[model samples]
Target chain A: MSRQTDSQSTTKTRPVPPTLSVITEGSPLSFVNPDGTLTADGEAHGIDIELTRGLYREMLLARTLDREALSLQRQGELNLWLMCLGQEAAQIGSVAALLPSDMIFPSYREHAVALYRGVTPAELLVQWRGLAHSGWDPRKYNLQMAALVLGTHTLHATGYAVGARMEQTDEVVAAYFGDGATSQGDVNEAFNWASAGSLPVLFICQNNQWAISTPTSVQSGGQIFRRAAAFGMPTWFVDGNDVLAVHAATTAAAAHIRLNGGPALIEAETYRMAGHSSSDDPTRYRSDEELESWARRDPLTRIEKLLRLMETPESFFAELDESAERLGAEVRDACRNLEPTELADLFGNVYAEPHDSLEAERRSYQESARALAGVNR
Target chain B: MSTMSLVGALNAGLRKSMADDDRVILMGEDIGTLGGVFRVTAGLREEFGADRVVDTPLAESGIVGTAIGLALRGYRPVCEIQFDGFVYPAFDQIVSQLAKFRARSGGRVSLPIVIRIPVGGGIGAVEHHSESNESYFAHTAGLRVVSCATPDDAFHMIQQAIQSDDPVIFYEPKRRYWDKGEVLDQSDRNLHEARVLREGSDCTLVAHGPTVATALAAALAAAEDGFSVGVVDLRTISPLDLSTLEEQTMTSGRVVVVHEASTFLGIGAEIAAAISESCFYSLRSPVLRVGAFNMPYPPAKVEDAFLPSVDRVLAAVDHAMNY
Candidate 1:
């Protein structure tokens, strides 16, 4: 039997960081520069003007919901909330580049992807409200529920692509994860499995600098994208904060897989502008200098600058601001009004088939509850 | 009815399932060209083609993790874990991902995936190859854990496990893989129900997987000594057929649970506790459990002493009857 061999070099080379935020040797691929001007590569990509405007609108809507969800967490309406405060461009741009039928597997922090995929504010907040383990139907949105267990969902995405291959579909399967998740063994295994099988799965690692308190410098030995090359996977490093760059890269990556090119990986260099979650305190671990630098390159702000430079109608900004407020209000209302999952409903879905022990326990619990209610009466 | 070995029965069952459903595919390490280490999946790749039977990279997590994705894509995947101890690497995916996918998705998504692991001691194999790890999966919610002791049960149970809408942890007894028995063309009972191999009024010996044959042997030896002992093959470990167990326990009035796993917190403990609660009045003695010591599976040379033997089972029966 012939072994699956890779033509890629096995010799390892140390990747020097170009800057504190970037992990690779070269500057990250960017379209919109920090100064609100398109880079030469960005101009050459020729992204549609309307798509750029839509990216800004989507990023703003995601930011609005994220801010309201964080505030609601502070007020104790939510049990917890992981802010996607910085990685909006990586989420919005990549998801927008995909076909609506393309499947997505997200690792918890992709609220932007969820909202872009048509998950309602109520459905998104229900999980954080401690009402349901998962809030939305995966089939309905073609987006899987948030996998809180780090990089595990990447394998599911690969396996889904394996199925897609048998069906001979042109659909691309995508998995969204963070740099911290790259440390997991499952993540590396997913990369190898997908590469070996030539599965049509795109691994988008939003290298958001910090995994809780652990920085990317200490978290990885070499560049995250460089690790994919060892698995013979096509690798791309992009400025995650640049929505235009991200959309273009993902569009090309998805097309490559659709054309039967093997699995690919895109390491999106971005920063976590907020704490890990409502529970984390980023101030203790990171610097004010770092925070200020990332704030200047904020995903929403970068696109808004480009929109202003393009002389977009002021009414477009006015209407979007009002829409953002409405989205925030909707999220706040959804978080507050979300119903708690009932005890009777809890055991219903544990198994698709009837389980004798679970059924018996449910009956016994109901009987005792009824007896206790009678006593209270 | 066809007579075949337990492993042959499983192979036939898997072939039938694949022939029956186009979505049924096999995934594991060495499952395709190698036909698996045990040869249970032999001749399947050639018959069904390489697409249906896959030989994956030597990663247990990769086998199960991708199976989860395939399940999400509307394919029923049967993942082979290679060995009992090797399953721990994929433990997170099975319990966290595959087991919880249905409930976590609020019943909207169900992973009809079967994780097949060859379980128990007495194989005289090296470390990590022979171990009884059923209790770990049975303890988990949202997973259906089952073990088939005979060729007849293996034939039907493997098919039933594949048909289940819920994710199943199917335990194939490696030591008994070559043991032969007659298998009917169709199943006579539900997948989860226990089977009474023999009826006795004095005591009942309960076992599953590799230990079922041992319990049957112990029952025959007990008959020589004038002690009538019944044997109950617990086909399903989780969501145990408690009614069948209680009914059989009532007949004997004395019960001894047996397994190759450590007695402490093994399936024996659960059976003992449940039978104690249900058959408290009828029981002549407290439920006794005969199993390996609560430690790592000993070396192959001493595995006979480590695994539950007929003498050890008879001793437990004698202890239960003494009361």
Candidate 2:
């Protein structure tokens, strides 16, 4: 059978989602309404104006860096790049809600989350530049290294959550993945385990609409949030473009986990505004009109409108622009200054302890390199 | 030390290891309540509590995947994959995640996880259940694969494997689960070293896991035939301790490798390749290997023919002796 079909056809007993009717350009779960004002549920939109402005600033800086990284890859400085073009609010909101002790396990594209966690720009680009396996030290941030496998980090996060619970630590775990990852067996297994163990894992899946070319509607029969509910996780579907909505949802989810309420799956509905990567051309699969529609509902632009509603002056916008420009410059220098990795790194880190067989191979390669040099001379 | 069955010794070893370290967790299907199918983890959950000896959902990937997380969280998890054939579901976790995490993390974090699987064929069990799929793991880098032949090694090695600061695939020969031997107070043996069981001058019988006893029996029979042969119990197969293998080759000048797995691209093939490279001048004859032919593990009724027995090892020894 095909993976994604109409929900009624897939399961006769399962009713259509109640919230499916309310999911227009605006969702009731959204904190910031279509009119650019906070929704009636004040608790859900509890984040203050100060924090909202800070989130906007962080998102803007992340966007600046992401664009420069994309440009660098185009210029042949980086091997390849995956940009967080439209999912900045989703990552920024959820990461900001997390406590300092909570561990984060992110899939490869969570660049903004890593930056917010104090991972330097040079550390982020070194892996893309073909210098190292991972840029930042995982233990330092209580965040794991960027996992390339799509859905695997969910299981890792669940396991880590279970471990922390076992250790009696109140620290929670959050795993970040895309919409496509929901289709993987690892993610399903992760769901089963988290529910079974009553593990405190905040599963944040940025449903960015496209998995390379496959849309979410084609990835699964039902809504992504519905899958989590089936696994008995407290599931929340939010408008990911609204930073306030994401922050409020994640804050509640984090509190639920910290209070021993078990795992929660928050599916942030967003869009991937750019191609899948530097190698992809989205025009081949998706039409420009659909892109234009999403471009109009851009998260940054929506927040800018709200900032004006709050009577924020032009100087505030000017200061943000100034900081973003400087941040972009720093990212450029960081990517350029990363030193090339030595050949010895390949032989190193194979094992914590010394290994005779690997050492012999390393020695053999060195001797051959020297021989080739002599011949060239 | 009392005389104990291999499974009993393993159970005792697990209990001791858990007691020795509070962080060691045991997870697998039916392990907690059912005490595992083979009862290898019998009586563990009661003492350790349900939290420590967890009865995981019937998902191998989930078991290994979560164990990797627990390892990251500073716990040494020993995961039991129900049987040999059932291990493929967890293969990705073992190979990609558990095996690669420590090295890829640049030595900052260590995954001290143990994946214990009952391997090899015999006892008329169904297909899938009876398998010797050790080579797939042994071939993977960043994994330590070891097997135990006797109760003494089973008792001692389980603790040692748990103690290592790396992921170790501990394969227990299921056919020999009932085999009895004295559990010594302690064995002054490192976890990865090969052991010289019996010394001879004519040939060396190299084997591991299920086939080690067969090789030993072959050596005894070969002695009566005036073909003095040595037997080496290859305890660990990954960082293969070939120094003992080299010693066997140098002493006898002729050696025969044995395993229950298919000889085609098998662990025996690796042994032969290493011997050919290192013992090119010291060897008297080509390293002959006796293993199951490259075919699916046959039905139980015909498994005796498929598995390497004492006769097959002796036949290989005779062939090498003729050389």
Candidate 1, residues A309-364: lDDT per residue as tens digits?
88899999999899888888888878878886788788888999999999998999
User: Cα deviation in Å at residue B67, candidate 2?
Assistant: 0.5
Screening candidate 2 with a backbone cut-off below 3 angstroms (N, C-alpha, C), the clashing residue pairs are: none
> Cα RMSD to native, each candidate?
6.4, 6.7
CAPRI-style class, candidate 1: high
The clash number for model 2 is 0
Q: Record all residue pairs in model 1 with backbone atoms less than 3 Å apart, i.e. clashing.
A: none
Residue-wise lDDT of candidate 1 within B1-323, one digit each (tens)? 99999999999999999999989999998999999999999999999999999999999998999999999888999999899999999999999999988888888888899999999878789999999988889999999999999999999999999999999999999999999999999887999999999999999999999999999999999999999999999999987998888998889999999999999999889998998888899999999999989899889999998898999999999999898
How does residue A237 of candidate 1 score in lDDT?
89
Residue A244 lDDT, candidate 2, scale 0-100 = 75
**Worst lDDT 10-window in candidate 1 chain A:** A1-10
True contacts kept of each: 0.92, 0.59
